[model samples]
Target: MSATIHRIGGREPSLEPMLSLVAPDLNLVNAVILDRMNSDIPLIPELAGHLIAGGGKRMRPMLTLASARLLEYSGTRHHKLAAAVEFIHTATLLHDDVVDSSDLRRGRRTANIIWGNPASVLVGDFLFSRSFELMVEDGSLKVLKILSGASATIAEGEVNQLTAVRRIDLSEERYLDIIDAKTATLFAAACKIAAVVAERGEREESALDAYGRNLGIAFQLVDDAIDYISTAEAMGKDAGDDFREGKMTLPVILAYARGSEGDRAFWKEAVAGRRVADEDFAEAVRLVQASRAVEDTLARARHYGQRAIDALGGFAPGGAKDAMVEAVEFAVARAY
Candidate 1:
């Protein structure tokens, strides 16, 4: 890999080079995405579009398309699979905003804020159903099973997060497990299905799945760390939103565990009890930085980032492989 492979976007790098590599297939995926999102109930598309149109890089679907190309796939089923992957992602975002009561997304008003939670939740369900409809149309029982299982796992992850909210003692192992389900499973499935459509054997499938899994873990760790270090505009929401929401991300978990006694008390008072004092968020940021929690969290991300790179060792050296390797850094280096 070239030294340029580690380049960041001066901030958040665009994945356009990677996305561009599979632009033709991506166009087809987009077409399928729009076509599947359509519904007889006019409000369905309208509500779903509210969030879908506000996409932040469309990374999940891009993973599917790029994974297919990396393995030299040329079939149309990956398009349908990519669309299914996108719908699953979109549904989660819609439902997450409702669960989080978040006011912002992708630097825009959240869908739940505009359409209301009931409408957002229902539309999320509709999108999920639409995802499966596309799945069934593809006539791949294996794909159906993988995607359906992923949907269930996403729900379980969300439920776990729900239970953890407002609790300050969440362990690192538990936190990793939660994020693995909530974020990484779909990523693994997205890439794994690429090899499936290509009729590649278990080795290729496992390799791609490992790549996507590690990348997803690295991606979420960066997102968690950046919530403390980035601007609302940069993060598409307020910095420290996770703290405000009482999310025990790795940064918080580290700060709490490794912190001084005063630090532990401050964290418990601020996050554990759901305190909303005017200065509470500032104090939380201060503690997170003082502990170097974000930095340590990112160190953890870099580990997974390397693992993601290693998982691609079986692929032939080329533009697609190079882009995939760079993308692992894109998952973490931007936070610097």
Candidate 2:
């Protein structure tokens, strides 16, 4: 599923404590990204800054730092690795907006919408190239292997989603398979790379990898939930963007499966058939809610959150590790 929803806004200061372990480093990483965005090429720098300042939660890189700290990694490579993750993520956002023909992202005009698709796509490529440069600076073939593998998986996931979009016969199992490839694989790689850097045991590395994978799945589940449940203003983007784009997310899959005959027919004609009426959007939301899919998806997320915490139990938990646990918990319980 797409995860461009939610921001650092809406919540109060209390949530700050959940990410305190690596917030300072995260801020530094942001500065590094901004500084690197500077280019002699005139409008390139400005457009890059506009995309960078669009206000992201920086969740991917934060996970990298948190995972490193949890295992007592004390090297500068962590920062570079974190920034690499962010670069890949930002590249994906640029490409996703173009593929979806999106106009709004984080409640602002998309780079494609304002600067045009050519610029957005080219800048995104620039970010990808810069990320590869950072990876080379890390000087670890293992790190390169993990990240390159993730990049490939992310691309495959995008292709899988394109093949499945608007197909009502899409099963819940297939939807999950797509997300596991597209979303969770990179997250798993991020944490696993930290484990490799920390020289953790094979068993611990696998456990941490599992933790990241499960956490990523939980994160995406909540993302899908918020898209169906949140308002456009609060979510920092248009609500039902997925529905309008003919993407078959979890909520719609469950609702369409359980909908009454008329509701089902309406979805087939409007949602699947690409003739979405005004009532179709509202009714899809209602049917999904009525199916209790949101509750079911939330339960799945909580299950994954619990599993992630369990994975961390193999290590000697400390303040930083405890903070990582709290971050995962907060990710699930976050009211975005």
Candidate 2: where are CA atoms >4 Å away? 1-15
For this target, which candidate reaches the highest TM-score against the unseen true structure? 1
**lDDT per residue (tens digit) for residues 157-229 in model 2:** 9999999988888888988988888889888888888888887778867987898898888888888887778
lDDT computed for candidate 2: 0.80
**What TM-score does prediction 2 earn?**
0.92
lDDT of each: 0.86, 0.80
Error of 1 at 9 (Å): 13
Task: Return the TM-score for each candidate structure.
Answer: 0.95, 0.92
In model 1, how large is the Cα lDDT of residue 281?
A: 76
| Model 2: ten consecutive residues of lowest lDDT | 1-10
RMSD of each: 2.6, 4.2
- Cα deviation at 322, candidate 2, in Å, is 2.0
